[model samples]
Target: MLSIVSIGLVGLPVNAQPLYPTPDPDVFYTPPAELAALKPGDVVRARKIDTGMYVGTEGWQVAFRSTNSMSKPVMGVTTVLLPIGVKNPPLVSYQALINSLGTQCNPSRSLFNGELQDAAGAMLPIGRGWAVSLPDYLGPTSAYGAARLSGMMTLDSVRAVQKVAELGLANSPVALAGYSGGGMATSWAAALQPTYAPDLKLTAAVAGGIPADLEEMALSLGFAPHPGFGLAFAAAMGLEREYPEKLPISDQLNENGLWFREFTHDACRRFLLFHGAFRNAEQMAASKSLMDSPVAREVLRQNSLRHFDGIPSVPVFMWQGRFDELTFFPPVAEVADRYCRAGARLEFRPYEIAEHMTTAVAGFADAWNYVEARFRGEPAPTTC
Candidate 1:
């Protein structure tokens, strides 16, 4: 059974139902009725995708028409749900570093085009007629962590598009894409479609600069110095969301571990931006003795991608830069090898000159091309 602390209702733990629910309708703010008739444009507006728990919150499911094709629709989405204040938008708001952990450290200047730069370094608009963006802040399972929940969130976002279509609001073919953490979500959605939502036709998926193996990342970051501290912070937050049992603290922590946990959660992007300049995880661990507990080790063990049992059911395109310091190449290679051996169709591409940032930027074009071909009813491309 799931439990949710009702918002603004102090000390009352309510039994959360399986289907996502709405907060108190009386207090929840509904979108202005005028927004229903507005077409996609420069301004970002607040709109409710569903009625229940997803209401009141800034979280929204929005539609953007594709410029290239009137009939086709592509969905742009992310898992970060909180309303980003202009003074302090959440780290996930930045499109380029959306997948990276430390976004809050370096906030972007432009809200509309902050992280949406393409390979050529030009601004891409969320115009009427090409792709619809769904800021799926509810995340997978309307919560974070647990890969399967993330997958469900992605699938549901697509379902949201179909729901809008049924109401004569919009229609478009969906090409799911996300970078870094968003990439992980997209990958899970593609893989889970065969069983979870087989009726939804997912043309293709693009997962660039993916951190396929979380455990390896933890192990690597745990042993590294400064950046490792940041990684440890990310791990703690991820574990807390996915596997709270592994958290050592019961009633919220106050120690160095807790301090780092809060700091990392609040400033994940800052840590990533400066991770390479600092020492690896080992140096930091030695100084702080952060990983001294068995619980920390167990968190790494549980959150690692190695714990996953099978390859995704659909064809996947994975790109990794050889020089990526944040997420190394070995674990990604291992995942690709395992999936390929499992007879799962996978296109694994390695960029010799690409690092974490460049890998996603450079590979995104190809990823989109691959998806376009698939959506045109072409056969799956050969795995590289």
Candidate 2:
């Protein structure tokens, strides 16, 4: 269990803000006893889908018990889309970039209501007769940027799909793919699989334009003209949800900052990016350095995917744009090198004509082809 103790106002006087908003107890967050008793990837409930989530696909939206960042039990929902006329199809968990601060923006919910933003990307695998599982990787609370929690939920979603007798994915080959915020989920799931869910036996994992180092990205986007400043601030709020005691954010934020923080709780990623672009993070928190506190440093380090030493045992394909506006290329390159040095089979590619958005679009073909090849039992090509 992760213990997070608040480091009360140190040489600073400020009003204490509410650390966390109280969520409704009757809804999605209320975990069943079966969920807590089950292991990380155990199914809590399986129900037939009646929603238009995946318009062309017909499958069940399963609710499964998953482990959180604190190793506690939590519930996650996943839409399992099986190929229309195929049997025993290969499984792929398509982690969409749902970078919202609200639960309503989750891909699972969007799929049900037909509001998914990445339907085009999801169509690639669904069109190829591959079974795709779209997991609400951020889980019920919309813990955006909480990579560990995302990864755990993702892995558990796959387990839930496989366990559902109606899905018939028992012996199917599994692959993973995502980009941007979704990439963070894919990367963490891949890295943690070897230890956390070794039985997953993931064939290949593809991540593009990944924000591997959250701390670096947070600091990098702290200044003007960069929409990342808002996104970074959102991440800090997300982290506070996971480690409230450690990030007593309410105490540090000024009155204006407090309002901004609360207002963003239900804001979408698009709204956040342009909401307060170019604002300095220090000004928002009234701190000289966001990482000044020991608690802050530890929380940031713990959440950073790049700092973790786990090397994915499965073949990994990582693609980054030559110039990504949101996540700079240096840290992405550094992570690729780190994985390669850790003796993992990794193919790291940088696209020439790709910006952040274009890289995801340009790399989709390659990413899908890579996963397709893996499902076909072909050996993954490695740059290492």
Q: Pick the candidate with the highest TM-score.
A: 2
lDDT by residue (292-375, candidate 1, tens digit) is 445445444443344555466666777888777766677777777877888877788888854566777788778766765665
Poorest 10 consecutive residues by lDDT, candidate 2: 1-10
Query: Which candidate has the highest lDDT of all?
Result: 2
Candidate 2 lands at a TM-score of: 0.90
Tens-digit lDDT track of model 2 for 1-384: 011112233554443444343453434446686667788787777776664545667777788888877777888888787867798988999998787777656775676444567867876888898889989898767777688898888888988889988889988888888998889899889999989998887889999988777666655553344546667667766776765555666577766777788878876677777885766554565554454467665666676777888889989999998777676677778888888888988888888854688888888888888888888888878787
Q: Give candidate 2 regions above 4 Å deviation.
A: 1-29, 51-55, 223-225, 279-283
Give per-model TM-scores. 0.62, 0.90
lDDT of 1 at 303: 33
| lDDT value, residue 131 of candidate 1 | 38
Rate residue 372 of model 1 by lDDT.
Answer: 59
Local distance difference test values of all predictions, in order: 0.44, 0.75
